[model samples]
Target: MIEFKNVVKKYDNNITATNNISVKIKPGEFVYVVGPSGAGKSTFIKMMYREEAPTSGSIIVNEYALENIKSREIPFLRRELGIVFQDFKLLPRLTVFENIAYALQVIEKTPEEVEQRVSRVLDLVGLSAKRDNFPAELSGGEQQRVAIARAIANEPSILIADEPTGNLDPETAEGIMEILEQVNKQGTTVVMATHNSFIVNEYKHRVLEINGGKIIRDEEEGVYSNEDANA
Candidate 1:
């Protein structure tokens, strides 16, 4: 579970990215953070993974107090969560299988354990056959799938995606969504920040509509439209 109470993040340039934001995301729930550019969606998601620290507030993610978590302990905290980015950050030289296995290897998982976990996640993302291919050899969608596979290879309880489908075509984005849906179905809490209103309306979930660094609306099975988002 994730909880943020009275979270306020400010930069040195006198800009407030998030203002007194408080929200609770329960386990086994799929939540969408939708808003226009510079609406604090990225900053909000980045805070969850400890990429950015709040100026003052409490953020508890899977029992780790992000605001006070030590640098060394951040790795341990990350092990309990999976994160995917808009740009597929894969090792260009490594094969798809190796890319997924790298994360497990860093944590000192046994060779057998790494192989098993990597295989399972690659299968989950439907990229088992592309296991031997390098990132450069794969399509954009395939690379994203590889990224997702790598993120979830350790079976993190929480999966966080930031504009995961931002670079893919409509059909390819839908395919990625299906993979995420499957992951969520298996009990991973999914928190995604997206601008694709079609995806939001087509696959409804809890929506936290943010604007001007504040949550304007929180609705279960919320539908988003361009007009509604800007309203």
Candidate 2:
């Protein structure tokens, strides 16, 4: 589970990216983070993985107190989390399998274990047939599928995606959404930050609406709109 208490992140120029934010995302929960551009959504998610440090307050992720965790401990903490982005972020030169295997290889997972996990995730994402393809050889949707496979390649407890569907067509985005939903069902906590209201309305989840670095609304079965979000 992830919990934040009275968190605030202010940059050197005195602009506060997150202002006294707090929330909890339970294990196995699928949540959508919605708001306009620069609403602090990305900053909020980044803090969970220690990609950005908080100037004040506490962020507890799967029992790791990010506020006090040592730098040496970050890699261990990251193992519990998976991250994907708007851009596919794949290594263009690496094959789909190699891209995913790199994550485990860095952590020194045994070759057998790495091969087993990579094969499983590739099949899970319906990309087993394309395992040997490089990023340039695939379609956009296929590339994203490979990205998703690489992200969960390690069986992370929480998966964070930022604007995952930003570059995909609606049909393709829906495919990605379905894959994410399936991942959630199998027990990974999913937190996605997106601007697609259509997708937001189609899939009801715990919605957190943030604006001006403040969480203005937290709702179960939340829909997307500017009514409360643009404030």
Candidate 3:
């Protein structure tokens, strides 16, 4: 579960990325965040993951208040959340298995435990065959799947995907969505940020639309509702 209370994020020169935004996401729910460019969608996701601190207001994720979370405690907070991004942030030299295993290794997990967890998540993302491959060898979709596997390897309670399918073709994007849906079905709360209207229309779910740094609309089973012709 995630909750934001009167959250505000401002960059230098008084530019507000998020303006007094407040929202809540319940456990076992899947939600889509929709917005135009510069509408604060990225800032919102960063707040949830503690990548960007709110200038004001409070953020509570998986029961820990992040507004004032100590730097030393951030690792513990992140242990309970999974994060995926538009760019597949995989290390070029690391094999797919090693890439996923590195997350556990950082937390000082035993070698045996790391191997077991990496194996399970790679299987979950259907990338078992590519375990020894590097990121450059895989297709775009395959690379993203590997990224998802790495994120979920630790079994985080919440998953935050920021424009996860932004680089893939429609068919490949659909495949990634299926994996996310399956993950959500298995009880991990999923919050995804995307601008793809086709995917939005195809996989209808709760949508929160942001505009001008504020929540413009919140709808259950909603489609992309941007009024701009170019959107």
Best by lDDT: 1
Evaluated against the true structure, the overall lDDT of model 2 is: 0.93
Candidate 3 residue-wise lDDT, 147-209, digit = tens: 999999888889999999999999999999999999999999999999888878899889998
Model 3, runs deviating above 4 Å: 225-231
TM-score of 1: 0.98
Instruction: List TM-score per model, in order.
Output: 0.98, 0.97, 0.96
Q: How should the candidates be ordered by lDDT, best one leading?
A: 1, 2, 3
Please give the range of 10 consecutive residues that has the lowest summed lDDT in model 3.
222-231
Which model, 2 or 3, shows the larger lDDT? 2
- Which candidate achieves the best TM-score against the true structure? 1
Q: What is the lDDT of residue 173 in candidate 3?
A: 98
Report the C-alpha lDDT of model 2 over 1-231, residue by residue, as the tens digit: 999999999999898999999899999999999998888999998998999999999999989999999999999999989999889899999999999999999989999999999999999989999999899999999999988998999899999999899999999999999999999999999999988888889988999999999998999988997554555
Residue 51's C-alpha lDDT in candidate 2? 96
Check candidate 1 and list the clashing pairs: none
Question: How accurate locally, in lDDT, is each candidate?
Answer: 0.94, 0.93, 0.91
Query: What is the clash count for each candidate, in the order shown?
Result: 0, 0, 0
